[model samples]
Target: MAHLDTLDDEVPDISPYVTPISPTNRFYRIDTALTVPQVDPESWRLRITGLVDNPYELTYQDIRSMRLADYVITLSCVSNQVGGRLVGNAIWTGVPLYELLQRAGVQRGAQQIVGRSVDDFTAGFPTTLAYDGRNAILAIGMNNEPLPTRHGFPARIVVAGLYGYVSAVKWLEEIRLTTWDGFDGYWVPRGWSKQGPMKTQSRIDLPSHGSRVNSGETIPLAGIAWAPTRGIERVEVRIGNEDWTPCRLGQAAGNESWVQWHRDWTPSGGGRQQIQVRATDGSGHTQSGRTVPPRPNGAEGWHTISVDVR
Candidate 1:
């Protein structure tokens, strides 16, 4: 195993709030591994075992020969606080995990599918999710480039609508189906939600807080919103105690990808002012105003930032 970075919260710094597609180099990563595993594609083997009628292994070439699809998706770390910089969007290329599982033929008793990494790290989710219309895949490419060593080189796991802790297994070596009723991921025992569904969240990107913008001039307020399986329907911005105003959303590739939103705001009076943002998902659920920390699962509440107007 090679050395690894424990946690990286580095988000896009240049107009980060407006950039819809995050560059592969600027994406965030979180891991508990003390060292990253280096797996050679030529020597790699993906084994499917346990509770299956046709247990088999697939070589790297085997994976490449299968039909490949592009998944433009956004993923966020569970530890990210409200308005935190641990979220990113990228186009991942891989084969749908469902295809592999179907070929292996899951047994009747299988309840969960566990993905074990070369570094010995493991995380899995309910088997139902694999066939439940969610796009879970074994990602071999990130942003049109080969997967980075730090970001699961040969391949990794990406499941729509789920948090990274329970689904994003990197440097994958084996996928095993389990009938254990009490199976838990690495983070579950360490205090996290077992299911790990992602929560709807938004962030403010433009007009750095504390920077002064001239009053009477229209200032553009913008950011990004993500809801995974359920797309963001609308984004609303609040100025100080003013009523919520709708923001124009940019074109989105799909429901699984994050969308950009922006609205022009003209400061009424000079001095300090506050801006807050909230989002309503395609399922008609709006983000709550109640503030909560990102523990056990994900964070909650609107993203608020204060700015100075001259």
Candidate 2:
């Protein structure tokens, strides 16, 4: 977690609103299984089975030839604690999972779309989310480049507004359709939520935590806010005894991506300053002030940060 620095005229607006992390940025990575498997693209195949009318398979080349869709999506882990750094944004390129499922002829009784990775790890979500107008993709490209090995090299699923545990299956190998009662992905039995809808979250990214600034110096307060598929409507920040003030929001790439925000602040008195930030989604839901630990579901509450002012 990088801290915010003293704002100077030469400093480019350090707000996420002014600049978003690039797709190729060093994103946080996690694997349920101990090992991250390396797969050969040429030999790999994506299997579609179970409740699909046409049980079939596609090789790397076969999938690449399909109509490729692009999206800038953010992925959050269900285990992300308050003010966690496990979330990231990327421009993903792939076939829409909804379209692929349609082409494969999903059977009428199919209730879940389960993704299987080469390592045998699996996770899934409701079948309706695939065709219900969400930007869910069987992603193969990231940041205009081939997906990186550490980030699910050959392919992965990019479903907006859901925690990675339920949606982002990395190093893909299969897509299986089944009844809701017939399946439990890797995380469900382990106590994570079955449907990992993302929680609205906001974070302070600048002025590295615990850093100091001179009293009365105007500083740039910047961070990012996200609500996934619903998008972010606004972000507000409160410093010391001040009332919440709206921060400027950056243009979002799509409903699934995050937006940067920032505000200029000058300290009235020196010592320690505590700041609280919250967000309202496009759906008109403001983040909860009540704090909850990340558990079966996502965490809820405002992110608070403190800094020193001499």
Best by lDDT: 1
Cα RMSD of all models vs. native, in order, equals 5.6, 3.8
Residue by residue across 1-310, what tens digits does model 1's lDDT show?
A: 1111211122233374346667777899898779887788999999999889999999988988989988888899999999988988888889988899999999998998888899888887998988888789999988888889999988889999998999999999988998756477788788887788999999888767777889999877777899999999999999999999999887776889888887777897778899999999999999999998999889999999899888
Please give each candidate's TM-score. Answer: 0.94, 0.93
lDDT tens digits by residue: candidate 2, 1-310: 1122222233374643334544365677867868778899999999999998888899999888998867778888888887788888887889888777877898888999999999988998999898788888999998778998888979999898889998789999999999998999998999888888998999987766898888888988888888989999999999987899998877677678888877888877778889889999999999988999999898988999899988
Model 2 whole-model lDDT (C-alpha atoms) = 0.84
> Ten residues in a row with the worst lDDT in model 1?
1-10
Relative to the true structure, candidate 1 reaches a TM of 0.94
Provide the clash count, candidate 1: 0
Which pairs clash inside model 2? 3-207, 3-208, 4-206, 4-207, 4-208, 16-260, 17-260
RMSD (CA, angstroms), candidate 1? 5.6
